[model samples]
Target: MLETVRRQRRAAALPYPQMTLAVPVAIEGAALHSGKTVRMTLRPADADHGIVFRRIDLEGGRDVTDIRVRHDRVVETTMSTVVGNAAGARVGTIEHLMAALSGLRVDNVLIEIDGDEVPVLDGSAEVFVDRIEATGLTALDAPRRAIRILKPVVVEDGAKRAALLPGDGFSLAFEIDFDNPVIGRQAIEADLYDPCFADDILRARTFGFLKDQEALRAAGLGQGASLENAIVIDGENILNEDGLRYEDEFVRHKLLDAVGDLSLSGLPLLGRYEGVRSGHAMNNRVLCALMADETAWEVVDFVEASRPAYAAEREMLAISAD
Candidate 1:
C-alpha cells in the first residue's frame, strides 16, 4: 500500500500538459476602450516566438511591427499597455489578448489586426479562450520556461499601487473603491496558480461608470459599447438585464487585467500580486522596475512540468501553474 501510494503521488506529479492554439482564426468585434469595430486574425508562431501584434493596415500592408511581450518594446502604459514599433504601427487595448494568452498559458502567437484596437469580444477572455479551444490545441516538442518571482517588487502612482511578492504560485489580491453604488468598494484575491480564469474570472466583462459613457462617446470612444458587451453602471443600478458574473466582480476583473499585463514580461511570473486602483501605467511601471533590477529575477533553464516535458529551455510559460 505504501508503494502504491508513492507511485500514485509520483504519477500525479507527472506534469501539467502543453497546449497551443489549433490554427489561424479570424475574429471581428469591438474594442474595450475605443469601442471601435476590429477585424483580426490569429496565426500560430514558432516556439519562443512570443505573442506579437501586426498592424496589417499599415502603409506596407503587412506585419511591419511585431510588438513582443517583453519589457523593452513597451511604448505606452496609459489606459492600457500599448506596445509599438519604430514606425508606430500599434495595436491598442491589448489587455484582453494578453489576458487570454497569459491566462490560458499560450506561448506563441501572432495577432494581426486591421483596426487600431483588439476586439473586445464578450468583454473578457472567455471568447478568445473559446475560439482557441474551438481551433484546438496540440502539444509541442519543447520544454517550458517559467519566471519565478524571487522577491517583492512594488510600484505606486499617487495612492494607486501594485505589488508582486514571492509565492509558491501566481495569485492576485485587489481592492477597488468606486463612488458609484452599483460597484462600490469591491475586493478580490485570486489564485492563478490553480488557474480558473475560465470560470471565476474569464466571463466577468469590462465595466464603466454610466456618467462617463456619454462623455466617452462625445470624445469619439465607446461608439460600439453596449450593455451586451460591458457593464453599464449608474449610481445605484446595473444597466444590463443580468446583474453580475460575480459578487465582487470588479476587483476580479482588475486582477485579470493585471495578470494579462504582467504577462507582457514574456514570461509566466510566479508570484502573488496585490493592487489598489492601479491601472496599466502602474502595472507596466512595476514590470519595468523588476526588469531594471537584476535581483528581482533570473532566467530559468527549464520547467519540469509533466511526463513528456522537454529538456532545454526557450518555450515560454510552459510551467505556468505547475
Candidate 2:
C-alpha cells in the first residue's frame, strides 16, 4: 500500500516539483549601495524551505540570523526591495537575484550572504542566471504551488498603477515613462515562463540619471555604481561607451524588476500583472491588496504534467486591464 501511494505521487497528473540548486554555488562582488566587497552562496534546501537569506556577518558571525524573502517581511522600498527579520537583520537589493531564481523556477534555496546588500554584478541578472544554470537545479518530491488570481486586484499611487487580474499561468506587462529623452515612454509584455526572460530581460542593466548621482550618493545609495555595473544617463546620451544591450532596455529592466519583486509573493503567481510607471513600492502594494482580499486569489498548482505544456500559456495573453 505504501509503494502504491508513492507511485501515485509520481503520476503524470501531478504538477512540477519544487526545485533548488543541484550544488552549492558562490559569487562575490561589490555591494551596490554600500560599496563593500561581499560574498554570497546559494545552498540547496529541503522541499518546503522557500527562498531565505541568512546574514552571516550579523553579530560578528557568532549567531545565525535569517530573513525570509517574502512580501510581508519587506521593510523598505525606497529605491530597492528590502526584507528584514524580527531582529532587524535585513537584506537589500535582492530583486535581480530573485528574478534569476524565479525565472528559472527554483523554489527552494538558502541564500547565505556576508553583507547587508546583495552584490550588483553588472547591475543585471545575467551573472546570477549564469551561475545558477552552471550549477543546475534539482527537483524535490513536493509539487510546486502558485497564487492564482481569482479576481482583478488593483492599486494606484498618484499616476502609478499596478494590477493583477485573473488569467492562466503567469504573465506581465509593464510600461515606463521617463522625462529623459533617451528613455521616454517604453512598454513590454511577455509570458514570464517564456525564453524571453533569459534571452532578453536578464541582460538589461539597471540605470540612473547622472544628475541624481550626487543626491543618491549623499543619501548613502549607489556608492558602488559605475559604468561597468549600471547605465548612467547624462542628458540625452548614455555615458556607457558600449551602449545598451537592448534599444528599449529601460522598460525591460523594469519588467525584470517586477519579476523579482512579485516573486516575493511567497509562491509563484499564476495571473496577469499590469503596471504603469510602477516601481518596487507599488509592486508590493498590489500584492498586499490581493492578499488582503481573500476572494481575489487562491493557492493552487499552476501546471499539470498530464496537460499540454502550453495550456497555461494559451489564456495568458487574452486577459488585459485598461
Whole-model lDDT values for every prediction = 0.72, 0.85
TM-score of each: 0.85, 0.90
lDDT per residue (tens digit) for residues 1-322 in model 1: 2222223323444433333566887899878767667899988877777788887767663446566666667787655677877777777778877887776667778888887788877777888878876666544456556777788999887789889887655778888887776777988877664435567876677888788888887877777778877888887888889788888878778887888888888877766788999888888888888878889887663333322221222132334325
Model 2 residue pairs with clashes: none
The model with the greatest TM-score is: 2
Candidate 1: worst-modelled 10 consecutive residues by lDDT: 305-314
Specify the highest-lDDT model's number.
Answer: 2
Cα deviation of 86, candidate 1, in Å? 1.1
TM accuracy, model 1: 0.85
In model 1, pairs of residues that clash are 15-305, 15-306
Provide the lDDT at 173 for model 2. Answer: 96
Judge candidate 2 at residue 261 and give its lDDT. Answer: 94
Candidate 1 residue 164 C-alpha distance from true site, Å: 1.1
